[model samples]
Target: MIEHKPLRLLRHLAWIPAIWIAWELLHYEQYKLLGNPGSVFLFTVLTDWLGFHGYEKAMRLGVGAMEIAASILVLIPRTQGFGGLFAMGVMSGAIFFHTVSPLGIDPYSDGGVLFKEACLTWAAGLLVAVLRRDQLVALFNRIAGRDAAVPA
Candidate 1:
């Protein structure tokens, strides 16, 4: 009995975005996001608009931590599905911010590189979700205590 090799490769690819995001976010023991006034202002506006007041630093830290955790999870075969789902959620928020907030598609004037990365990461997450669907189902079954036979 052999497993599908391409799906395994796709599942592994999901970790790439998580690692990149975590590096950009949690580098140097500090949150490196919003380095400029425009980025900060955009975040302030988005935070206020989203109705999450008085905890912007905490929010950034929390989100970064989530990315780091997802990065770790996706690298491990057993937790890849959970990690991919979590990373997708983070990427979705990013895409939404870049789309609707003052963040815009070209924030940081990086020729829309950040936005492109977010889109690519989102797409990779989708690939992981579809390629590892069975693993996700097995995870859910285990969580539900149904004792289903999960793949090795």
Candidate 2:
């Protein structure tokens, strides 16, 4: 019952991006949820620029909730692919806002730390998605009512 070495290595490697995405999402949850100054500022600028001034709180809370969900999903072995997809979606919005809104690359003026993190997390999520593509395909098959079995 010996597994091929490359397969074993790949299985182990999949956890790296999953853990990195989850850690970043969870670490920032408090700031987003608790109205930390930086988080509030970022959201404010985004909402203002997007003409959603009155909905800043809603947008912030919604993004925070999604991040929490993504973190939870990414940490679970069975749902890692979905989590990666979710993380990528969320980070995509963040990256888009950072680039398009008044919130430029260096929003906090800290040399674009937040912007860089979003980009890195987006890339990591892509890796997770690629690594767990089998699960993603299976999920798609189930949703589409297609046969899930693979030919031997």
Candidate 3:
């Protein structure tokens, strides 16, 4: 059995908040830097998808809080698995948004912002995989045993 030490787990957990803060800081001026047209278009899409129209300011704040809560949940041993899954969904949505927006116009156009987003998406997936490796292994074992027990 793979042993997860508390210190090691905490170290990995620390990356969750650290990374989110870094991303927010780095992209604080994303709407302005990328252009207002694109910003308005993306925001509209977000509002429609999240059903948070007429309260854009509150929506943004809520999203940030949700991200923080998810990260914190992922740090707790008992909730880490579910939290990781939630984080993965959030990251995946981010990746999809970037891909389908003007953000994907050109890799070189936005100072490699799309590239950074892609990297972050992959990082989130990798982190979740690492944190849940034992669960994944167990799942695989169960499937493999079932296959072996079946008659040809």
Candidate 4:
């Protein structure tokens, strides 16, 4: 049985996006968890806009926890797709909030760095998820009580 060379190369290259997603998530952990002024300001503005008011701490901690989980999953070869999906979900919320809320694209006046990173991270997560779609399909099959080995 001959394997397609492009597919083989893609399989190897999949790690690049996986690592990027993981690194981005893990890198932001300190800001979210440790109450960095920038993170605090962002979350405060977001919570205020959402009418969550004083729940900024909870939101920040919750997001930080999820990021930690996603990063760990992304670092594992077998669970990379799940992690990517997790990242996409989280980043989707971030992108939405950034665009719709008063936060705007350049909340910190840092030239929209945060917004751009979120977009790039979302794309990276998507790439990783697509690359590991086989695992996603198998997982879905298992959840749906179908045989993963059988074609749908």
Candidate 5:
């Protein structure tokens, strides 16, 4: 199949956020991790601050796994839109936490770099979604099993 250059370029760019986020969460030892004290502390604080405690590890591991999955999916040509959608979801949560939770924009107290990265990633994912809109529409049409006529 002939590759569309613009879509292909966008697809490649979309992988940046996914891979960067997944790496931050997983560190190449995603599966082997069982929740570190740092992660536990952060999640604990998040839960307590948000009153969503009692599932700290689940939240951490679950989001991390999803981020990793989204990253992997973005690497494939056929699933770029799905991956972008998944990434947008994950980044949305991250941005929410950074804004609302005690985490603030500087969770690590570094200098808000993490928050900035989250924003960038979210924006990139959104861009990818927009660039791959045709694919998303096609998928939706397939799933809905009907072709809706587009108004000129």
Candidate 6:
């Protein structure tokens, strides 16, 4: 297992660049494969969800900074847990927005995009959860130890 650690790290690290590239591609409209309407809807949803409705300029800078920080933390072994937590928070907000806005799946309509986003968010959260499992286990163990030491 130890021998494969490097490969595993590489795979995880690759997601960062891939995500960045995809973001850039979308931002520049270099790839319209997803359709303009869908892209516009997604951007509007993101901006609104992020509380940048009337603050587009600030959000433009803030979002990039936040994303870079999150990506950097995620790639750093010592800070991966923190990064994962941040990612989970952002993704959860996204999922909530989609679910609450009537933008999600519909049996008779083309609402599958929301479903796809939700699934992706879950997958990302799961990745972080798995990455931080050891820390979680250790925290629980510490709490259990403290309880065991109590006189009651």
Count backbone overlaps in model 4: 0
lDDT tens digits, residue span 1-152, model 1: 67688866766665665455445434522433544555455566667778887666666656667777766776666776677787789889989888988668986687998788777777766666666677889978988998865542
Q: Which is the better candidate, 1 or 2, if ranked by lDDT? A: 2
- Tens digits of per-residue lDDT, candidate 4, 108-140, equal 788998889989989988988898787788989
lDDT of each: 0.68, 0.86, 0.53, 0.86, 0.70, 0.51
Candidate achieving higher lDDT, 1 or 5: 5
- Of the two candidates 2 and 3, the one with more favorable TM-score, higher being better, is 2
TM value for model 1: 0.73
User: Could you tell me which 10 consecutive residues in candidate 6 have the lowest summed lDDT?
Assistant: 25-34
lDDT (Cα, tens digit) per residue for candidate 2, span 1-152: 56578855665677999899989988998898999998988898988998987887899999999999998888887788888899999999989988887889998778999999999999988888887787788888978999783211
In the range 16-51, model 3's lDDT, one tens digit per residue, is 744553354335444534445654555556666666
Identify the superior model by TM-score, candidate 2 or candidate 6.
Answer: 2
TM-score: model 2 vs. ground truth: 0.91
In model 4, the runs with Cα more than 4 Å from the true position are 1-5, 149-152
Cα lDDT tens digits for candidate 6, 1-152: 15368646644654554354234323433212333455455555557766668554454445445555665555555555455555556556546756666444432267665456545644664566465555445545657884322110
TM-score for candidate 3, please give it: 0.48
TM-score of each: 0.73, 0.91, 0.48, 0.92, 0.77, 0.48
Tens-digit lDDT string for candidate 5 (1-42): 577798577656756654554455446234325666766777
- Model 1, residue 53: C-alpha shift (Å): 4.7
Alpha-carbon runs more than 4 Å astray in model 5 = 1-34, 147-152
Off by over 4 Å in 3: 1-55, 103-110, 135-152
> Which stretch of 10 consecutive residues in model 3 shows the poorest summed lDDT?
143-152
What shift in Å separates residue 121 of candidate 6 from its native position after superposition? 3.5
Itemize residue pairs with steric clashes in candidate 4.
none
Q: After superposition, how far is residue 72 of candidate 3 from its true place, in Å?
A: 0.6
